[model samples]
Target: MKTSLILGTALALIASAGMAEQITVMSWGGTYSQSQVEAYQKPFTTETGITVVSVDSDNPAIPIKAQVEAGNVTVDVVDIEYADAIRLCDEGLLEEIDPAILPRAPDGTPATDDFLPQGLSDCAVGSIVFSTVYAYDRTRFPDSPPRTIADFFDTGKFPGKRGLKKAPKALLEMALMGDGVPADQVYDLLSTAEGVDRAFAKLDTIKKDVVWWETGAQAPQLLADGEVVLSTAYNGRIFNAAVSEGRPFDMVWDGQVYEYNLFAIPKGAPNKDAALEYIAFATGTQRLADQAKWISYGPARKSSAPLVGLYQDGKTEMAPNMPTNPDNMKNALASSYDFWVDHESELTERFNAWLSAS
Candidate 1:
């Protein structure tokens, strides 16, 4: 009888172990993370019988480097910005994502040809295209609202605190744009010493009125709480706040800097095969399209565009709200991943110095 009981316990333990195949994915938290959960993680788990443990970070890129260097890898997959993906891959901290492993389109087009340009990189696969757009609370300015990024920096005219990311990435680009640099010439202007100085000088104009945010969640919260009347946020955050939570925020697409968030498997990741499999599955045509229903960020795949429709509310048409919408792109600038990859570290140092100056 004791042997029978022991045998039953052993069988149960083995079964539990088999069923517990797990992968931890670190992502920027809030609705963006929730979108991934709804569109990818949950579906991946259900289909692959793999448990996904979701983790949040102000920026996953920062911690991924630390984890890889320390050789104490806990995360299997991380969703990070494109520049970080490129930088990390260059630093030998991330695993290469072979384009061949990616799922192709239904028309039998190869993944390379199917994905948008720069969508598939050596170390990462582009997941979604998000943007940094300033949104103002309609209740704050019912009549004269900020119409452009220039207006966001005009404290005298706007007369309210503004929220911006603490990082230099999008802010510098927008600052240059607000200073009348053409969208096409933003990166070129930023490349020289003069261009860098111009961006910072422009930033100095409204630095005092700017409330800096470190996390994606903090942007909309600042606007909601009136800590900031206008906040530069990921388009999806403001969209979710306005659509889901019934906030009175409205977006300013002018001078918005759009960029991609990608999924990169870190070196020494515990479940490398499962992580790779998850990326392939998650970035597939259906999964990318599915993500749009949960978040307004456009999918990286061209095929997914037609599949995108109304938001979760079913009343608001999602097409017009996307960062990739043609109308939205009129005055927009793509955040230069190459520029950021080249300058991220130096810019971080410069920003810190400037932040500490006054």
Candidate 2:
């Protein structure tokens, strides 16, 4: 009888361990997401004994919509763009966060406070802050490099072939800025008809010189191949291309449009509890600081700034682009996800029309 009781207790413990819930997290697959999982998610599973199932989605919304519509919710947490986060929340497709169960800053303040004011929202939280900036091939432009959006438009001053995103978000902002609108007045200008036309008119000045990039990878490639002397690109992709390929390229952060990649729990998630736990772990200050070292993309948590001490090789100048630097953080123009959400379709149509005319 004693032997039987001991065996039963062992089986109970095993069963309980087996029953520990697993969570499914969906994100864009690339070095950034992979490094994040390796550095944070894998360790989280080891410490908590909860399994994490990472999945890839080209368009995060597609899978989410399919699952939710079918009433068979599988994804627990999703890493998406801020615009999509706002759309999903409006559609009632995401679970409201319970911050009480999540991690707090070391000061015991809520972690939400560590993010920029625009970055905080009721149903989603900022995870990564990425920049859309100008990259130039140092070899091609040995004498001059584009420093700002105004320079990007001035073909005669910094004359070189140029590349821009096909998307309207960054281009529209750049257009407004180049048309003599101040950075602070960009959104306001775009909100008016004459201002919108002025932006497109300025873009027309460089239409022939501009090559529109469809993907993040294309931008850096154009720079490396000398197809375009300068291109607007994601800082991470451009940095990687320059470092890995020995390309003579550098990024100009001036007048850059910064957008936040967000993480949110999907509605009716099978493992909502585990999903929140995973978000808290991934967004912790230490983990974010570590991530900045791996990828140049900036951390959303303000506290992660100080944790990024001098780089291993003492590259101080390179440190500003390291994501944790206050100056870079300040220069980044926080993208208005709400505006994008409201005007996506119309903006897309206008962009397509402008591209066709170009």
| C-alpha lDDT of all candidate models, in order | 0.91, 0.76
Q: Please give the lDDT score at residue 267 for candidate 1.
A: 100
Q: What digit string (tens of lDDT, one per residue) describes model 2 on residues 111-166?
A: 76777554556678777788788888877667666667787788898777889988
Among all windows of 10 consecutive residues in model 2, the one with the lowest summed lDDT is 309-318
The residue-by-residue lDDT of candidate 1 on 30-136, one tens digit each, is 89999999999998999999989999998899999999999999999999988888889999999998899999887788889888776889999998999999999
Off by over 4 Å in 1: 1-20
TM-score of every model? 0.93, 0.86
Instruction: Please name the candidate that would achieve the greatest lDDT relative to the true structure.
Output: 1
